[model samples]
Target chain A: MDNLKTKHFTFQLKDLEISVELIEELARIDDSMPEYSRFLKEEIDSTLSLSQIEGGYTILPAQLDQNTIHIGDHCFNVGKSIANKFTNSTHIAIFTCTTGPLISDRLKELNSQGLILEAYLIDLLGSVMVEKAMDKLQAIIEAECTSKGVNITNRYSPGYMNWDVKEQKDLFAFLPENFCGIKLNESCLMTPVKSVSGFIGIGEKVRFIKHACQSCNSTNCLYRNSKNHC
Target chain B: MEKLFEQLAYCIEFGKINKQSPYPPNMKDQEGAGELTGQLLDQGVSADDILQKALIVGMERVGVKFRENKVFVPQVLMSAKAMDAAMIQLKPHFANNPGSQKGTFIIGTVEGDLHDIGKNLVSMMVEGNGYEVIDLGTNVKAEVFIEAAEKNPKAVIGLSALLTTTMNNMEKITIAIKKHNKNTTVCVGGAPVNQEFCERIGADNYSPDPQGTVEFLNRTVA
Candidate 1:
């Protein structure tokens, strides 16, 4: 079974917003949490999901540096090095989000399980949306790069080591409303539970970012986020 | 009858937590696992019978589906939720009945990583399979795991990483756990980890999904 499937959805990015009740609900969950340390996480997750629906984080296609470039802001940047490496190279990535209305229903059902369910659904929604957005962004990048005689290599994003996350501000500088409503918190993270920031490299040579799998060093990085396999 | 068990498994597998849950609309308003399990218990079915015979069976199937990508997080979360709801009614039976657990399992998202969906899924699956789970939560340090292992001397450890960057911490924590207790079994999973990476980190096992983890734990305890 392939965990990765090609999902296409056309969503109106402007329709997303932060839900105040979600924050309160998350806070209520926090107060009852068995583990105090995880309180902040529960709250952040709730806030992120609400933010994602509010439409703050987004990506766009633009002509950058004589290349068809994909730009994202207020979304997740895995690392700085990965982001820089993409900028210096060429690859095609599709930037899109889940375009269906089933998210609210899905989230509602998940919420019945517990507050953590709400937070999780929101996070999953954000990630799924980001993945979908990336797919759309990839198609645009590929079409643009192909016409320019540049074969795409691979995709990369910010938040990786060596790629300053502070650039999140700069990455969104060109977009109106900071690229679809996703704004930087004080720490430079997207407010929406599901958002991402990155770029796709388009070039003639095949340059897969060495950061994925064992070839990359994730353990040593100070800015590491999410204890996940991917 | 076996039909009820089949229906119960479908509820757990599709994530039909209860009648009120609106997901997977086909099951909407139907008798959910909560009601069914409660009904089964009220009918004099042993709690152990329900757990091993129904809840565990349902959860195990979903875990494999999740690992194989036949189902995604949303679907699996529903299954876990269904299993959890059913477990709430069966906790007393677990306590009343001894020698039911496979063993203790300590799980957490590695240090510097904050994601918990994958880890939580594993926790529910392990718990559903009759293992006592100590979930350390996310952003856990190597020392935290070691501390847990020290407390539960017979416990096995599972490490989860969602980001490429955080996967690095898996090795460090594995090394630390092994350093303190060489006998400690370490298993790793997440989007970026695999068996090859597991061996490279010197961890004892790597399972692609929660069911795999359950099977491994069962073997060890057996």
Candidate 2:
């Protein structure tokens, strides 16, 4: 039964709108010949698949006694390792807030076309990965709250509906190594192409509702926000 | 007649484009939608009869398959491409009759989102369903959408975003459009977007796939 459940949990790579041009560019970045375009096409032809088990999930496995929780040993240890690799590490700060950096230069690019590249499917893939990772983390955190007999609120992250992006630093500070394998570049991006760090509020006042993309202030939200709720 | 329609629908369902266009591995050098459609036209079939009876019938099946994940993007893209090939030959008749299209649809990726594969797929599907789609390209701002909506009052608006960061921008634009014209129906989509986001932002509709979007537009216009 458990084996069947695990197999059922396997998720196909959800559609990440990829352009023919970007596939070509990715091929170039790999230093493959232009004929490699055919290879890229073939890969695109074959949809990408990812699973929750591959994403990895862990329970908080403990309880928080206070509303204002600080980055303690385990989370700090993980975050510290992440911070060390980032440039301009001194200015990198962490906080506990709802809003974080939702948009950044890390998402946009400049090219010879004189037009800024507005979005990338790779970025979308990363966003989807982060969202699924967050879901796994939420499962763990929620379980912790339930085991402790506390009603938790929504998993709020920086750059949420009304939350400001500036609070990303605070969220980073709370996590271990700013997230195990994820790093914040000078421009404030979590690397590894697949990672997320956010906090789930544990209280009675936390709004529990279906995630709605239209309700959020971030209209152009790409990560699994309210967009997936419906 | 039903047998002929079935073959044409099969050609479209499996993405058989013509006698020469090779794809799908199984249907090499087979008669595609193009030839079948042409043959139907030469048989004194009304343009509307062929479109409604044959082309749209197959596409609706394709749409349902796409929605159920029975097919993926590449297959759908191929189907859309094949649909376009057939439409090219049918377009002249539509040119003769201006009322052929159900309505106009304006689509784009909201500002901060450069992704267009979703928008393009929707455009192709909507076009396949015989609606004229004015693709505004990507990274479009609220004002651009408002302007386009004002210009094409009959057209449905579609906004797409492929990044979580840009999802916020989709909301802002949706709000801005409603503020300008409350009646404008904005359809929100993308991999991350769902119906929940649509209601939250006050958009009229949300679709997980191109087929749903077409159905929404069809129901609205119907």
Candidate 3:
């Protein structure tokens, strides 16, 4: 097994370059709802201003045996869907990303004050922000891997695509305590609530799938597009 | 009086809280659900009539629209806000007559599942439909559900679990509630729950959306 090294990163909210249009698209809002469109435009700026994004990843040598992935001394029974996608992988990038606690705290505050609509919008905004941050982080990882002629596959998380969520503990084992200030509870839920963790396959033959929603069965996923073709 | 009811329903369906609220842009300065509800009560309309003819009718439209994908969460929440405004005017009358509600509903997110957006949406819809809702909040255990069911023997129970892993906990809670009282109607929902899982878990009903849950509850009471 190759020695593993964890890389950490912090980001300014501006680094994600989140746009109101992107949030509107994620929220399934269109030009017809002028009030909501205006509201999204107004809130996106303030919400992004308060966001504190951070992320990190650890690369470990890995081998796939049937449906299970052997990473260092730990074995991840990641299921056929993931194992099939990672067949060409020589290394696994275990990653965690979070939009920090401010957005969620604000959401809770709004909800407590009986501002449900505002809170819901903020909640959607937080999801977009964290995912956008992860996208930026993933791009960094991809760029670094590209320099070494190593390609990366689309990211996959434990709770999606039939992967057992309990395996989040095994995934977290690769990182230090509370890496990126995100903690996993016994139920495998992440704290800060607006955080995401997953794995990316890295190898010469591994390729990124631009639209992975087709293979995923999570139809109600927040990030899933309106057509379910994302 | 009929015109007032129609106007109030329109306000609620469009999510106009009051004359001062600037939503649904077309109805900018018109009297909204709040003012119209007050006027109807002043004109001798019973609170129950206002609820049945206006608020419930409006909320049902919102629910159907939400189910049809004609509207989304924020829009539904706005309608709920308008309903809240109208309900505030009717609260005193409802307090005087406790039997006016359709029935009782007990709801919560299953144990190990902290997500509550789906639960809250169902709660709001059920309440807007004139049911007395007892929300146990998120991460609620089977015992909590059992206790609530025991208190309101006729009440229907709703379980929500947004995580696939917590679906196991939902099944356990459903079994525990059924063990406590086999007659207690259990409805399960969430992003991850479906009719197939609901049947496997022994839940009485499963709804993919809040409107379906409302419809199930309406049928249970009927």
- The lDDT of each candidate is 0.63, 0.59, 0.85
The sequence of per-residue lDDT tens digits that candidate 2 reaches over residues A1-230 is 11211101122334334455544332222221112345434434552322222222222322232222333342222232122222121111221211112222333331122121123333443454445545544555556556866654455444454444444554554444523344554323344434444444454333445465555555345432221243
Name the better of 1 and 3 by TM-score.
3
DockQ of candidate 1, scored on C-alphas against the true complex (2 decimals): 0.03
Give the DockQ (2 decimals) of all models: 0.03, 0.02, 0.51
Give the C-alpha miss distance for residue A188 in model 1, angstroms: 13
lDDT of 2 at B74: 50
**Deviation in Å, model 3, residue B101 alpha carbon:** 0.5
Which regions of candidate 1 are displaced past 4 Å? A1-117, A128-230, B1-6, B19-29
lDDT of 3 by residue, B1-222 (tens): 788888898888888999988887788888999999989999999999999999999999999999998888767888999999999989899999989999999999988877878899999999999999999998898999999998899999999988877888999999999998899999999988888998898999989888898898788794
Best-to-worst order by TM-score is: 3, 1, 2
The digit string of per-residue lDDT tens for model 2 on B161-222 reads 76666788899999999999899999999866888888998999999888889999999974
Q: Identify the CAPRI category of the predicted complex in candidate 1.
A: incorrect
Q: Which candidate is the best by TM-score?
A: 3
Contacts from the true interface found in each model, as a fraction, amount to: 0.03, 0.00, 0.31
